[model samples]
Target chain A: MKVKVPKTLLTEHVALLERVIPTRSSNPLFTYLGLALTPDALVLFGTNGEVDLEVRLELPTEGEGRFLVPAQPFFQLVKSLPGDQVELGFGAELSLSSGSFSTRLSLAPDEGYPELFFPSLEGPAEPYPLQTLLPVEELLKALSHVRYAASNEEYRAIFRGVQLEFSEGGLRSVASDGYRLALYRLAKPQPFAKKVVVPARSVDEMVRVLKGMGEGEVALALGPGVLGLATSGSQGAAATGKGQLRMAVRLMEGEFPDYERVIPKEFPLKAAFDVEAFREALRRVSVLSDRQNHRVDLLFEERRVLLSAEGDYGKGQEEVPVRLEGLPLAVAYNARYLLEALSPLSGQAVLLLSGPTSPSLVRPGEAAEGYQAVVVPLRV
Target chain B: MKVKVPKTLLTEHVALLERVIPTRSSNPLFTYLGLALTPDALVLFGTNGEVDLEVRLELPTEGEGRFLVPAQPFFQLVKSLPGDQVELGFGAELSLSSGSFSTRLSLAPDEGYPELFFPSLEGPAEPYPLQTLLPVEELLKALSHVRYAASNEEYRAIFRGVQLEFSEGGLRSVASDGYRLALYRLAKPQPFAKKVVVPARSVDEMVRVLKGMGEGEVALALGPGVLGLATSGSQGAAATGKGQLRMAVRLMEGEFPDYERVIPKEFPLKAAFDVEAFREALRRVSVLSDRQNHRVDLLFEERRVLLSAEGDYGKGQEEVPVRLEGLPLAVAYNARYLLEALSPLSGQAVLLLSGPTSPSLVRPGEAAEGYQAVVVPLRV
Candidate 1:
């Protein structure tokens, strides 16, 4: 296989592939990225058993063949080249030459390269059951707000994914790690019949890719065991003729817990406070919180809330003013969980509590229509 | 002891003390910072056996006493306070209160606190043998260029410190760890009896302090076993009536090797190249270098140099143009050592090579009068 491509274009695609490729795996082939060249374009593929990413480049090429090379070293070498054009030739080895320097790198056999099967959008044999279109920026923003709540514990496979449910009202994304839960709702909804649980790792990668592309439309398709996301090679006006990029991740096969019942229905004790000010006060007082549990107490009064923490080392307390309309109450919680729950919020935030042991709900103060986060209280 | 001080001022001084205190130590007192309040000033002290730092704040006080508090927790509490003025009271426990927030932290006995002995700057009781005044910025810049060459190996005490030699000609700082040697010269020098070896850890703290101040003058006094650095507390125009800050580090007791012989005296092959370009090329090619050794080969021709590194994983090569004035040569060296030695250089860099096995000298191409770095080549 022989191909000539622009350095910048090749570098960008290789960087994307590197993100999906695992640094080490049981199968050595999983650490290598496959490159297939045709007369019309060059295709790059990277996978780590669970997720597969394919990027197509429309640059002109000669001769048709395939090769597998170590992703990290190959990417590093290509990125380091100083010339605008790079010439690549693949045989028993891969040769990359640019300007006055050339390097011949050893390649692994391509026989073991994993086969990537992208679900078809429309086909007679087998078609994806669900297909939807959404704005990349908005979807990514909503995912970022809830992804942190997903559990990192491997024992519970269902809690390790973000649940995406589409209905007549809107498209809702929900994630819970048992201790805390976050829910974000977007108004646009498609005619999807089933819910898709995207692995937390894939959600992170999606955010990274969409964030880099700025504003674009993503075509999403979900089948029985796999989910696919594709972008039609257009980033503003400069990326017109580039080939499309596709990504697929295996969906988790488990039943997600019923989170609707967990969210409190009524919040008798409610208080509204400046988001930034409350966050700052939590950060300061939490410094002295118990290292093991990170517990900080919140004492709500008439028009103010006192945040305090005590441990073997010392004790810290700070008072922040708030607009209140409820009876006084005091509750303790893991400061880290509260901080992470409040980080994605902006402007003023409202806190709703029913009792000391009951779960507390937090939402954006001015508008309570879109997002909500619920955190369990810890015993002091 | 009771004192009222501005939160920002006290926080800044405590930060300086925290840098010198060890996180954990065999002697528990080394983990605590000592605070002594007199009618005139409040003095903060922290020591880790090897280095001692004391900062004096001339704030209004009511009583005279001394106490020791854990460095990290105390600093965290003070930094988290919300009000401008903090009232501190010392008894069986240390109490820090501001506004409506207060914290009582358990304190260690002050009797175990390490005693700090300041070198006499004036008076006949015991005069410092060497005393000099220099701009803090200049001193820090020179130290930054050579400190990386100091060895972290505890067995070789001599190589773990930067040798400071003062004479009528200039103040020279030299550090070597067998593989490389760096020498920096400052023209403004004062009369001194002998050379002092300042530990690398102390040099790092000195740089941090000087860089934080931005611009100031440091009064340096060196005695037989200790070195004292004092700076008048003046930051811009707002800092007035602030007491001076003093820091002392115990000098390493050992015979330093003569590094003068390590620098190559004459070179048959010399080349000049753009510093930034060479650095970038090294960074790129070195990515594929061997994991253990990180060896990169430099092939110098008439007007260009080819940098290449090959490992079990892959190979990378890049060519950077340079101005050559001598015969062609090929040399291999650890990429990390070379990168660090060249980082402190600016603009054009001149490389003087004696042979493939001999030491190579690198200096600023425009003028080779102030600084020189010599690195020994490794077998490719």
Candidate 2:
């Protein structure tokens, strides 16, 4: 089989697919990118088993066939080619030529390559039972704001993912590492009420693809065991005027913890302070905090909050002026957790607390608007 | 001792000294920055055994004393301070306070810290036996052009450093790693004739310091077994108006190999091509080069250079247009060596080759100028 495509189009798609393709795999078949070519279009497939992605580029071509090439070398070759157009000829080895540059990449056996989740281009359109359309920016923003709180320990299973909860009220993105929980809400009713836990890695890959999405709404599909995101047109259009990108992530099979139980319903004490100033003070005072616990003490007083930490190295203290109300309080918390919780917030951050050891609530604005984080305080 | 200084001044000096201070040292004494306070200036010292550095920041103060603070934590603390001026009050602990931020850093015993080579503020100056002054820009430029070729293997001893040669004609910097050699010449004659080999790591620190140097000549001093670099005033002056920086590197204790033996004196064939075009073509063709030797075959044709490489993965080839003279030739070289040799050159590069297996000379311009590289070709 043979085909021709614009260099930029091929390079861009390969770059995106490279992110999902594992560099080293015990099974050699998993290291190859499947090239499925039809008479009028070429679909490139890449997968690391759990997460599969395919991108289609439309161009007038002569032949049709399916082949696999080692993804890494092929990716590097395409990026380094110095011509405006790339010609691919498949055989025992895949031959690629561009201007005065040419190379043949060794092909891998693809008989055992896993079938991708994307719908077949030639098959009858089997519409997903549930589908919704939403702005790509909103989805990406929601994911970025909460994914960092997901537990990185693989053994934690459900806690190592971001949970998407869809209800009549809106769609919520939630993640927790047991010690802290982050939630981002998008007030748009979905076509179906459902919940799914997507692995943190998949959420990261989704963010990468979403950033490259076009201005149009992205179609989201929720199949039995997989969640799909598809986008096409303007943003990454080829000169031939045809391009589409699709990503499917295998949903984690477990129930996320009942995170709402940890969020305090009411707070009698409130301390509002500049987010940037508070972050800086936390960073400074935490320098002398215990390396293992990273504990920094917060003493709420009239018009100011004093942060202090003492360790074998020495002692450190800093004061951040704040608008305090209700009553004075003293609390000890992991500085790292508070830092991460505050990272997604901007402007004045209001910390809602009830006691020294309660689950404290943190909101970006004067009132909780769309985003909030609950951090469990450590006993001093 | 008690003193106060501008935050920026202390931060900048600490950053520079941090480069020479090792984070983990078996002898804890080498991990601290010595703080020596005089009536008019505070001198900061840092050393990694082989390289010692000191910076003097002048400020009006009363007490005179010396103390040591763990370099890493102190560096971090200063960088995170949120005030304009930093105050230090010494006792059992080094008290540091800046506006609303304050901390105490545990002081290490200063009696065991290595004595710095910088001149004492109250003692009579003992001038270096050999001294030369040169523009910091010229010295930095010369070092940058050749230091990458230095051998990194500690067993190679003298070859793991940049050799500085001072003669009646001028100053020259040369380095080699057995496979290739690079030489850069500065035409300004020196005040004395000498030869010294400065380790590649020390050269890097010198480059860092030179970039921050004021617009004036830098004094080069050579004492027994040491190479000294000193610069002061204008660029890094404290608000109180006095500042000075000095660095000393222990010289490698062996004679540098006679590298002139490898530079071929005559060339029966020449291939001159655009440096950037050749670099890109080299990068492209080398993608399929053998992982072990990175060998890329170069075929000098009538008016172009054809580069090709074959490995287990595949084969790659590209042609770079060049102006050729003499007989056409064929040669194979480690693509990495040629690439590094070309990195320091711009515009047209002239390749002077005698045959396929001999050392090939690469010059930046049509005629040999101030820089050249000798890359030994692999017999393929």
Candidate 3:
């Protein structure tokens, strides 16, 4: 179909498609990006068996043509050509001629492209303000950190997935691989109360879409058996499964244990210090930490807090002066998790609330923004 | 031995070591970077089973201490730490203490460090005029044009490497992977006669050292079995094989095939145009190339270079005006190779010298700067 679309818009969509498109695969049909020319818009979908990516761009179309250009050449050509206007002449062979660069590239068969449809999710689609939509970037950053810690070889569902819990206080994310647990939470809007476990694959795609989301609020929809989340943007506006533009995420059907109970609520000992100071100290100490060692000992004494992690290799210790409350306590917790959780803390002051040899609640103080961590004690 | 050394220099050595060091393999010594400290110098050696690297710096020491540091934590900790001069305290723990950052890393047993004896080569240790040295940056820039053409997985050893042939004319470099070849030469060089196949890996490392070598010349020590080429700066110098202050290289022993046989010395038909103009056209036309069949059929007529690569997926073609000499010729060649080979050409005019269905010779006719390619004609 003959259409006139904004060059930047088309280029941006194509750029994102290029990132998600499968390159080295036996199925050339999978490489085809489907462009459906509608009366007032153009719908582009790039799917490679496992994931379906749909982006709907507003355009002026006089006639209709389905352009299934071979993904590789088209991306390469568009990237190489410096142009504001690209004339796409679709016949038996799709020819995209760029006026600016004086270049023309032909594409593969459009008909050979497999039909991609959004799976029929049982629940109704709910829209979320792209911003409010589960700390899009924040949650993604947290997931990527500890996702490395999750066990990959095991076929057990929860072991390879990240647990997302939205409760009375805010949102919490936890990932573990039996030996250690990385728990991260951000205290924000309080009304919601729900929990869902998302596989790494889903989290990856979510991270992909979240890349474009800015200050706008992202809407989230949690279904009975599935999870549907959409952000307001060109990416979020993509026409996905079936005819919908929202991404349909299949939530893991597995039991996520009570990570909360593992977090000790009452501590006879407590230590308060600068979050930045502690994070910096940990960064220094972590350098000497044994990768095989499970923990970094946090010793609380009068007017001082010591963070140390070392083993047969060597020892790294950082002592930061702090106001000690409750009682003196020395507990060992995973340094990796402490670093992961401390990273998201926005300000300087941090409250290291301990439950005497129990799981420690490392929460960002009132002046500090967001973020908290709960670490199960490690016997050094 | 305790002395404060610039962290950046130590970090730089560690960075290089990390890339070359391989863990968990035979030749366990390859994973350890030998640290030899005298009152005058601190020399570090990093070696993989395939490649070895040695760098030296100045640090005060009470006496000579030679040991190999386990590269993993040593490199990792060095990278993470931020400081100018870090106090190096090697005692019972061998700890590197900096403020809050302290790590006592394990050292690999020091039994197998290659005995590093400074090489006193046959070549005039009398330095080549610094101005006479190959402008490393220039050579590196030129090498990149053909480096990609070298086959990564070499079924045939020479084919997998870059051929550096030096005759009376100049330095001609040719790299290919059967499907295509990229041939280029620097016409302006002092008289030299010798031929060698330099490993692409060696070339890559040489390029890294050459990046800052502006007017500084590379000292050539043509050894009995190797090409020992070294570059020096105010700080130090490095090369291919095991050497002290000077870099040494081992030349390939096998004979490289006669590349001249495939090159077209005489072309009855020819086309000439601006080098960059032709390069841009090739790049644009290449976007239409199908991986299944990698060819761009050029139909040269009266005054235009009509490039076409058509197959099942699609067709890509571009036509640009050019100056031609002799009879008209039509031939097809790998578009990717043509684009790559032509990309480095910077002259105002490009000469496409062709014969009766022979491989086309692409060179800059009026342009004096060197680089020429003999593309084997493809049957359309």
Using TM-score as the measure, which candidate wins? 2
Best by DockQ: 2
Local lDDT at A171 for model 3: 74
Residue lDDT tens for model 2, B1-380:
88898998899888889898999898788988889888887888889998898888878766998999878778999998888899998888899999899999999877777777853323224545777777888888789889889998977888989999998899999999888999988898887899999989899998898887756777788877888888755433565343688888888887687878888998999888899999998998898999999999999999888999998789989999999989999999999999999998889999999789999998987564688889999997
Model 1, A155-175: lDDT tens digits are: 877999999887777788999
Fnat per candidate, as a fraction, reads 0.76, 0.87, 0.57
TM-score of each: 0.88, 0.92, 0.83
TM-score of 1: 0.88
Model 1: fraction of the reference interface contacts it also forms = 0.76
Better of 1 and 3 by TM-score: 1
Write candidate 3's Cα lDDT for A1-380 as tens digits: 56554456677767766766788778878877777777766777787655567766655566776777667767777776645666665565555666534334345555666655342223233332112355566656656655654557565668777777777787777776665466665676645677777777767776676565544444556655455555444422223211224454556777566555665566676666777777777766766666775467777888888888776557767688887778787777667766765655555555555454556666656734344455556664
How do the residues B1-380 of candidate 1 rate in per-residue lDDT, one tens digit apiece? Answer: 79888888888777877788989999988998898988878888888887778777877778898888878888777787878888999888888888767777877777856678765435212445567877887788778889999998978779998888888887888888878999888888566646889999888987887776557778788877888877766432115634557777888887587767777888999989999999988987787789889999999998899999988877878889999988999999999999988989878999899889889998889774578899889975
**For model 3, how does the per-residue alpha-carbon lDDT over B224-265 read when each residue is reduced to its tens digit?**
445544555343322222223334445566756766677766
In model 1 chain A, the worst 10-residue window by lDDT is A234-243
Question: Candidate 2: which pairs clash?
Answer: none
Q: Give the Å error, residue B85, model 2.
A: 3.5
| Residue B297's lDDT in candidate 2 | 97
TM-score of chain B of 1: 0.91
